[model samples]
Target: MGEVLSIKSILGQEEPEHMNDSMSEVDDDSRPPEKCPHCGKALKYKKFAIGHFTFGSHLEKCDCSGAEAEREREMREKERLQQEEEARKRMKRIEELFRQSRLGLRFREKTFENYKIMPHNKKAFQTTLEYARNFAKYKEKGEGIFITGDYGTGKTHLAAAITNYLLGKYTPVIMGNVTKLLGNIKRTYDDSQYTETEILKELYTVDLLVIDDLGKEKPTAWVEEKLYTVINERYENYRPIVVTSNLELEEIEQRLENCGGAIVSRIIEMCMGVKIKGPDFRKQKLEKGRDV
Candidate 1:
C-alpha cells in the first residue's frame, strides 16, 4: 500500500508540470488566424522567440497574384503623393521668383494668345512664338532673340509675351525697361534696400533676362559701362537675354560706340535678330479715333 501511494504522488506532480508547459504554448499562439481578402487563402503566422522564451507571433505575407497587385497599387499611390509634394515645392519657388522679377503690371497681361497677327508682323510674331515655345532649347544654348524695329511696332509686346509665357512655365525670368532697370541700379548708390552688387548678381544669374527698349536709354558713359557689365557677364556665363530696341543693330552699335562696340558684338553673337516692320498700333488707334 505504501508503494502504491508513492507512485500516485509522482504521477500527480508530473501531470501538472506537463499541463503547465502546454498552457505556455497556447499563450504564445497569440496571433489570430487570418485570411487573405483578395485570394481567400489562409494567412500564415510566424512565431518570434528568444532562446526558451516566446515573445509574440506576427502575420506573414501572402504569396499570391492578388497580393502582388495590392502591393503595387499601394506603391503607386505613395509615389504619386511624393510627386505631388515635389510639384507643390516647385510652384512655390516659381511664385517667389516671379515676385522678385519686377515684371510690371502693364506687361502682366501680355501673352502669345492675345498677340494680333498681321501680314506685316506675321513673321516677327511667328519667330517670337517659336522662341518662347522652344525656350528650353534656346536657354540651354544661351541663345536669345534680338527684336529690332520701329517704335510702337510691337517689339516690347513680343518681349513681354515671352516673359509671361516663361513665367507660366515656372521659369525664372526678368523683364524690365532698360532705362528703368538702370535707374533702379543707380538709385542703390544712395540709401536703398539693395546694393549695386546684389542687384547685378540677380540680373546676372537669372534664367532669362529681357531688356525692353534697349537703345532708348540715354547714351552716357555710366550707362554703357553698366550695360557692358551685364551683357559681358551673361555672355561669359552662357546665360540668355532677350532684347527689344527701336533702333537697328547699326544704330545700336553707334549709340553705344563708347563701350567700344563690345555690347553690340556680344548681342550679335548670342542673339538671333528678328526685325519687325509695321505701322505703329498706338498711332493707328489715335488716327482712327480722330476720324471717328
Candidate 2:
C-alpha cells in the first residue's frame, strides 16, 4: 500500500541516527561537506557508490580504497571479460548455424576446373576435390589439405577447388592473399567497425577461412595481431582454416613474430605442416621433353 522497505533497511535507518555521525552534522544550510555519513570525513574528492541491500543508504561517500576498488575492479573486469568472451563465442555459434548460399558470382567463380582434369594428377586432384565438395562432411571431420607447391602450380586450383566444394555445404569459403587480408583487417581495426573482440570472433567464426601465402604480408603490429587473432582463435576453437604457404611454420614464425608466440603455437598445433614436394608445376608443365 505504501513504499515498502525491507527489514534490514528498516533497522539500518533506525540506526543511521546513532551510527552515521556525518548525518548528525547536517543542518538546513551547512551539510557534511559531501562526506561519508558513516565515517565523519569526505572521501578524497571522487566518490564511488554501489548498491548494498543490507545497508539502507541509497548513496554513501566511499573512501575509494585502492585494494577494495582493485578487488571490485578485478571482479568487474572478470565479469566483463567473461561477457566479452561469451559474445565472441556467440558470434561463432551464429556463424556455425548459418547457411549462406553461394552467390552466382561465388558459385560460378572460375577455378582450375578450366584446366583439363588430367590422368597422372587427375585422380589425386579429383579425390581432393571430392573432399572439398563434402565441406560439412570433412570440415566437421577436420580433414582438409595444405594445397601447395611452386608458382603456377595447382595451388590456387586446389585452394579454389576446396572453396567451391564447401560453397554448396551452406558454409562458403573466402579466398584472398595473406597481405590483403592483413591490410583489410588492419583497416577494420583503424575504422573501429570490427572491434578487436569482433575481429577475433570473425576470424574463426566462419565455415571455412583461407589465408594463402602466410609470409607474404607486410610486417606491422596491427597485421600481426589480426593474423594471430584470426589464426590463433581458429586453432583454439578447432575451426577449419586452409593455409597455403611457400614458407613453412618455422619460417612463418621467424618472419612474423608480430603474430605472437601463443598464436603461432596454436597455428602449429592445428596445421600438420604439409610440404608439397615437387618441382615447380609451371616449370614441369613448360618443359618440352620432360619425361615422366
Candidate 3:
C-alpha cells in the first residue's frame, strides 16, 4: 500500500492519487462551515452510512437557543391543530344531536336574542335566561323549568331559546311540540324502523328535554302512559326537563288525569315554575301587519 494517510488529513486536505478512484470528493475545509440560520452557530458535520458503506455527510442540528424556540413553535402548532380537530368533532356531534332533536324550522329562529322582551314576559325571560346560563350546575342536580302561560305569551319562545342555548354549548338537547312528539311516537307503532321504547329512550337520555305546547295534545290513555313513562324515567335518572304549557300546574294535572296526577306531580318536583302573563304577541303582530 502507498503511504496510508490519516482520515482527518484526507477530509481536511486533498485525497492521495491512489485513493482518488475509490473515495468520493471530501468536504472543502477552505470554505466557511454552514451556520445555523436560526442561531448563527457553525453546524456540526455528521456522516450517514448504510451497513459498511458510508453514503455521505451533512450538517447535524444545532443545540442553540433558537432550537428551543423552534421546538416550542412546533409544540404550539401541534396544540392548535389538536384544538381545531376537537372543535370539528364537537360540531359534528352537535349536528347529529340536532338531527335527532326534531326541532322544527318554525322554532329555529326562536333564540334568546330575538325574543321580544315585554313587561309581561320580562320575569319569565330573566328566569329562563338564568336557568340556561347556569345549566351545567342545574343539569348535575337534574333541575329544570316549567313555563306556563296563555297562548302567545312567549312560552314556547323561551323554551326554544333554552334549547338553542344548550345546543350551542354542545349539549344534547331535544325540543318538540308535545302534539307532534306524541304523534311521531304513535306513528312508530305501525313503522318498524323505530319503536316507542327507542323514541322514549332519546327523550329520557338527552341532557335536557323541552316539551312545548304541553296541553295542546289530546289526552288519551296511550298518550298519558307514554308521557308518564318519559317523565318518570327522566325523573328517576335525575335528568332535567323544560316544559312550556298553556295550563297551570293544577290544570296540567287535570288535563293528564289518566296518569293519576303523576305526570304533573313529577314535573312539579323536577322543575321551577315560571308563569308568564301578557297580551297575545301573535295577535298583536297580526294586527300590526293588517294596519301596515
Residue 227: error of model 2 in Å? 1.3
What's the distance in Å from true for residue 55, model 1?
A: 16
Q: Which of 2 and 3 is the better model by TM-score? A: 3
Clashes of 2: 0
Q: By descending TM-score, how would the candidates be arranged?
A: 1, 3, 2
Candidate 3 weakest ten by summed lDDT? 47-56
lDDT tens string, model 1, 142-190? 9999998898789988999998888777677778777766776877888
- What digit string (tens of lDDT, one per residue) describes model 2 on residues 1-292? 1222344355554433333222121122222336644444653322211222222223333655654566688899999888667656654454443223222254346454664455445654665666666666656755445554556545555666666655434454655666655544455546644455554455566667766666777767767776777776666666777777776666777887766566557666665444454456667676855774
The number of the candidate with the highest TM-score is 1
TM-score of 3: 0.67
List where candidate 3 sits over 4 angstroms from the true fold. Answer: 1-101
| 1-292 per-residue lDDT for model 3 (tens digits) | 2322444344565544444334443443434578888978886565543222343576666788898789889999999888767756755653443354467788878899999998878989999999999998999999999999899889988999998887777677778876666676777778646676766677778788888888778888888898888889999999999998888888878887789389988998999999999899899999999999
C-alpha lDDT values of all predictions: 0.79, 0.56, 0.78
All candidates: TM-score: 0.70, 0.52, 0.67
Q: Which ten residues in a row have the lowest lDDT in candidate 2?
A: 21-30
